[model samples]
Target: MKRSMVLVAVLVVLLGIYWLMQSNRPMTDPDRPFVQIDTAQVTSLRIESSTDTVELARRGDQWFLTKPLEFPTAARMTDQALGRLGEMRKLTLVTDRPDRFREFQVDDSTGVKVSVTDRKKTHTFYLGKTSPTAGTSYARLDGSKEVWEIAGNMTPAFKRPVRDWRDKTISEADREGFIKFTFVYPKETISATLVDSVWKVEAGAEKFDADKNQISRVTGLLSRMSGVDFADTLAADAFDAPECHLIAELALGETLDLRLIPKGEDGSQYFLRKAGAPTDYVIYKSTAEVLMRKAADLRPKPEKSAEAPPQKPRG
Candidate 1:
């Protein structure tokens, strides 16, 4: 009888331990205000950094550097930021009627305050304790202020997605085959055939090394193209402004004080004038064969070497 009683006690203890373990497991759909994010839904983002402010926002599936116009933003960088945000954990703690924007000072820095607005109208949270793992960090979010204290691999914090402007402008067909490129610098008129292999400048005599970096930069700019973002595209246009025109004219070896005009069958034509140049080179999209033929025609015909001298050498 005593042995049977002992067995019953052992079974009860095991059952109790199992119940406790199950209870400790994170509750997925608890009747609570806080929402959990899994860190992968984030795609594109934008980060602005300046002397007085730093702001981040995600857009599309990439990240953009909005502070300095010249700085390049990478997609991986955005992923890292989202990953960090996801690593934060939510503590069971809850606060009633969370304070909204109490102007709390961050890091004891004057004039630097973190004003978090719940744009999604979700539950407010305050940051709590943090637990970090090798590849992940678990942080607690205060249910009141919607604030979270995150601790984890912080290396991903600085990463961001690169802004692609031409995502909608250039079609797949446009990316294929050789295209016509006409650049008008101050005193030089430069034309290039963009082939699959290289940018044959001035009819293949002068080839510009289309290295990975150059191609990446060009592709990045093109990817950001969109009709709605005409201002940014137009600003980069080399023919619209006098300064750009002059830069183009002077930068390009050959220029006729003319601007470059791009004409395509798709009704994509633009007049590009050198910063100070008066003339422009009209460029139209042409097939690779046509460009090659044009270049061949322009090549100086082989000088009929003195036939007599050739005959004497043969004899």
Candidate 2:
């Protein structure tokens, strides 16, 4: 009886201590969303890594990348970042210890700091590497020591080079109903006009029917072309001695002119600049080949004459 009573007393004391400890701990809701922000209200964004920082601002409905370069932001890129933020849910608290932050890549030296601002308020957080759990990431709220396992891999959306955020479109013109097109090369010029849906071509003193397929390809590309990369070092003045020029006179009284500058020894790439534009865009040689078609290339190929039937009499 004495032994049983002693054992029961000890068990009661241990249970009491465990209950006290649990009561003293701060409560965390595992089901809570990682961030609570209205993405539609977001007016600006700042993404900072160890080596670079990118800042973007939204004016009305348009988003512009302000830092590193001043250009329009790619809508899909911005949408992805914002969409991930809105989708994140806190899975569990990884650690509350500051010393473990670096190990989880949530420290200031390693993590990507993402700040989103509305017209009045701003919320910031640090996004770390992907967590051990598939489709999850490690992140820490600004000014908090707690690191959490979030429900999405945020690295791809938030950690990108400046170029990926920029708009890659170089031209977005209407392909059909162009009044005229002039291709000016270093040694010759090829001009064409659309009359009753037929293309009439003039190469120097000669005039011929433009190959429909070939001319269509050129117009299609010129109507909607995107840059493979940006030539940040080159500007409008870099095309003073252009390798070729393409001028399009649209039916709506709009004119779009492009200057092509050759690059590299093997002619694998070319730098293209829009007339009066500040930046130069890099295009592949394949694109250049289409845009810089020679005068002879515009004419239809001569039909081959049918060979005379084999001479049976001689045989």
Candidate 3:
């Protein structure tokens, strides 16, 4: 009787060890890609969550956001997401039970649904919380029972805010390529031209040297100007009476115009509209002040005269 009991104990231990090994092994074929789709053939991408949904459609080589109101998206941002999907590899099987989906944050209420459409079919998947280990995330196919531990931190690529997906660049130009800048105010106009590589300003036939440092700051800001956020409510006709108009003349004879329209009673906000662009943007108060410079603001400040040395007390 004692020998029979020892044999049963050994059998149970062996079974437990075997179960652990099988559970740790990779479930799916490691050679297979997690998402089998050619990124080049992709036509559209969409991400839906409980709070918001963002959709992007490809037009030839360019990509634009179609849902949540049509807007241009950053090419780099979209490209990175597509690349991640194309290169995803399943590391191991996390779970296969429907009841356990919520524990992994892969349920309908918590998971972020991502759909990638190509010419022939659309591939949909749900992305859950990232794994505690770096460079891994929980993912599951739309119709599959198995949940996977996929390589790469897929949360950032698939779960981005709407503002992060949209392009915020308001103006992009070469600073050195600017030859002249004209500021038009309600009552007067000022022109600053590059004379012999030095900045000179003309206000009502009065020509004088401009502050080179100030001119540098203005051109630098305009070269890579970006808005804090979009002004979706502002209409085109809202700029009927702009507080100031800035025209940047490039060396190639192209002009980039910006109109500043004040908002609110305290004038703490302004709508910035680029000439011929479909979208309007809002800039911070500090950025608006830089573009709203007048003739006097660009002129150099008067230097203080040096005081003479005091006479000696003996004299």
Q: How many residue pairs clash in each candidate?
A: 58, 0, 0
lDDT of 1: 0.35
Candidate 3 on 160-204: residue-level lDDT in tens?
A: 889878888988889999999999998999999998899889999
The TM-scores, one per candidate, come to: 0.32, 0.83, 0.80
Task: Name the 10 consecutive residues with the lowest summed lDDT in model 2.
Answer: 22-31
Model 2 C-alpha lDDT per residue in residues 44-104, reported as the tens digit of each score: 9999999789999998889999998899988899999889878877877899999999998
Q: Write candidate 1's Cα lDDT for 23-141 as tens digits.
A: 65554323332345444554333322123333344455454444434332444554545554454443433222234223321112211222222333322222222223233222223
| lDDT measured at residue 256 in model 3 versus the true structure, 0 to 100 | 90
Write the candidate numbers in order of decreasing TM-score: 2, 3, 1
State model 3's lDDT: 0.87
Select the stronger candidate by TM-score from 1 and 3: 3
- The candidate maximizing TM-score is 2
Question: Model 1: residues >4 Å from true position, as ranges?
Answer: 1-35, 38-74, 90-120, 123-151, 154-178, 194-315
